[model samples]
Target: MDKERLYDELRIFKDRHFLQQKLKSPLTVYVLLALSYLLITILFAVALSRVSVLSSQLNEMRKELKRNHSSEDFKLFPCGPEAREWEYFSGKCYYFSLRMTSWQRAKVLCEEKHSHLAIVNSHAKQNFIMYRTRDKRFWIGLSDQNAEGVWKWIDGSDSTTGFTYWKEGEPNDSNQNEDCAHVWTYGEWNDVHCTYECYYICEKPAPL
Candidate 1:
């Protein structure tokens, strides 16, 4: 434990074979580390690019699948030749036929089947019916039978602002006797006495 002996031991420890092993050059080690880091960055960038491209392709494929499936679904429920046809877009069923009955009778028939006569709303819907019927005449729900000249749909909908595809000057109560409305050829509308029978169209909300 003398100072001279302690210094001699320290020197011996520093000069040992293990401690004398050649050390790595700091500059060379740093250069190798930098090169490895750059390689890793490049690899990561390539991997990210590939992943992005794959993700985009997957998204596009999903969209195409949805489009195809939706079209197929629509085709499964087509408008058939039944007295009532379903309108998928509106979730409603429509009946466009020529059965000629009084407005009250038509309403009663519709109610019995859990529906009411057709209520023409938009021009688009009227045109849609016309096209489906091949421009044939059908009765709508509108009528002024209660108080002549005050037309209203079965649902109490005011047809004043509604698109009236009426035949020109036809609802003039021609004989001052017309009390019912009916769709005519060319998608035009006309008024007739309720007693005069004509084909009618009925509409109902689709059952849930």
Candidate 2:
């Protein structure tokens, strides 16, 4: 009878220990699963935050490019910014001088400005020059500097086949003092003395 009671007590103790161990294992598993879930949630949230930030940066870059494109649209003129005050025509810039100087001095001034005297190569250009001069006279690029009767242009304009706006009975080289040419307000040209002081025009190619 004593042996039977000892066996029963041993069996009950063993069962109690097994129940405790089983309960502890389930609790540990639950804790590990909960921790894993929390870690996954945190990582997903971080990834979303990084994606949102990148999207915002991309949007800002697009806006900057749009602004730059808009600014470039305002610069439409073919001539450069330095020629804003000059007249732009046919890929050339014409500068009307406000000051007066002799023909030789005017040529020197135009050369110093990296340009040459205005050469009227076309009828449209001649009429444009005439309208711009108004009632004032301007010494043009034409001159007989090489020879007395051989009229030439400082800008190397070929007048043999080009148009001429010479006034009536002009270029007679009156009294041997008329070698340089000047344009009057009527668009007609007259040979004048080189020492005569007058307004002038300068011309140069416009920037592409």
Candidate 3:
């Protein structure tokens, strides 16, 4: 009876040791898996941060490139003798001298000088020219003489849609006989008789 009792106690000890060993192995495996997951998560976060920084830099570079291209695209005209004393800006040249001439005569003169009538594209530009002229009236390159009341610019642009600075009650064909457009003392546009004389503005494409 004593031998049997000792044998049963030994078996019980062996079973308990086996269970402890099995539990230790599975616990170690779980710890290793958790550590691997933490490492992967850290690496993914770092990669995403780097990608975000690079994207922001790329966008800034694109905007800079666009600004440079815009500046490079415009070419200044009448660069040499014609506007020798005048300052050039944004591909256009200005002459501040108040030289008055008839519309047809002005057209002929500008053509001889390798230019055409000036076409104002913006209010700022128009104001700049108007201010420079010392409030004197000048002739722009728009006329309706051939068509009688249908005005067109020297560059073939339609004046009807582009007229932004018309003088009050202007282009009224005041005498019911005005067929030419001219700038006024107040930096506005008005219709005048074709035979009337006025100072003129001229334009030409910039040299390549």
Candidate 4:
């Protein structure tokens, strides 16, 4: 009878220990799951923060790049001597008139613009003017209006001592009325009537 009682008590104690161990296991597992969730949330928040910082940095870099590009462009192309409708080349600024007018009117217009008619004194200047004039008959600064058979530049320089590209058999005083010299398409000079309408070129020294 005593032995039976002892065995019963031992079994009861064992069962109680096992139930306690099972309850403790479930609580530990729940704690572990909560810790894992907290860790994942922290990691996600850190990743989002990093992404936002990177985006802000990238935007700032783009703005800085644009500013630098604009500054460099300004440095490369500063204010030149040429104004609107003028082209700068070889220490001079030239204006090619789009409309045709009489040689005297063209000269006046150039003077009004603070310039003068084109005074080509070298082969290089003539070629440059011709290239721009193209096929158009553009009036230059050469003429014998002062004295027939005595050609002179607008600046009063003698034409014979400078440069002259007269076309073959040009300045022949055709009809006794051709006194003004104009450039032909082939970079040659021709004597045309001063009243004849033609495109013209203006020249001025480039500001230092």
Best by lDDT: 4
Question: What are the per-residue Cα lDDT tens digits for candidate 1 across 7-105?
Answer: 998889887744444336667678879999999999999999999999999999999998787666556653332332555336677765556677778
Q: Which residues of candidate 1, in runs, are more than 4 Å off?
A: 1-75, 78-89
Structural similarity to truth (TM-score) of each candidate: 0.57, 0.63, 0.57, 0.62
Candidate 2 lDDT, 69-131, residue by residue in tens: 555642654455555667887778888999999999999999987889988878999888988
Q: Rate the local accuracy (lDDT) of all candidates.
A: 0.75, 0.85, 0.74, 0.86
Model 4 ranges off by over 4 Å:
1-82
| lDDT of each residue in 77-196, candidate 4, tens digit only | 332423656776678889899899999999999999889999889888988887888768998888999899999999999998878899999889978979898998687899999999
- Residue 119's lDDT in candidate 3: 80
Candidate 2: C-alpha RMSD to true structure equals: 10.2
Best candidate according to TM-score: 2
TM-score-best of 2 and 4: 2
The lDDT of model 3 is 0.74
- Over 7-79, each residue of candidate 3 has an lDDT whose tens digit, in order, gives 9999999999987887689777798788889999999999999999999999999999976654554333245
Q: State candidate 4's TM-score.
A: 0.62
Q: Which candidate, 2 or 3, would have the higher lDDT against the true structure?
A: 2
Clashing pairs in 1: 99-199, 100-198, 100-199, 173-176
> Which ten contiguous residues of candidate 4 have the minimum total lDDT?
73-82
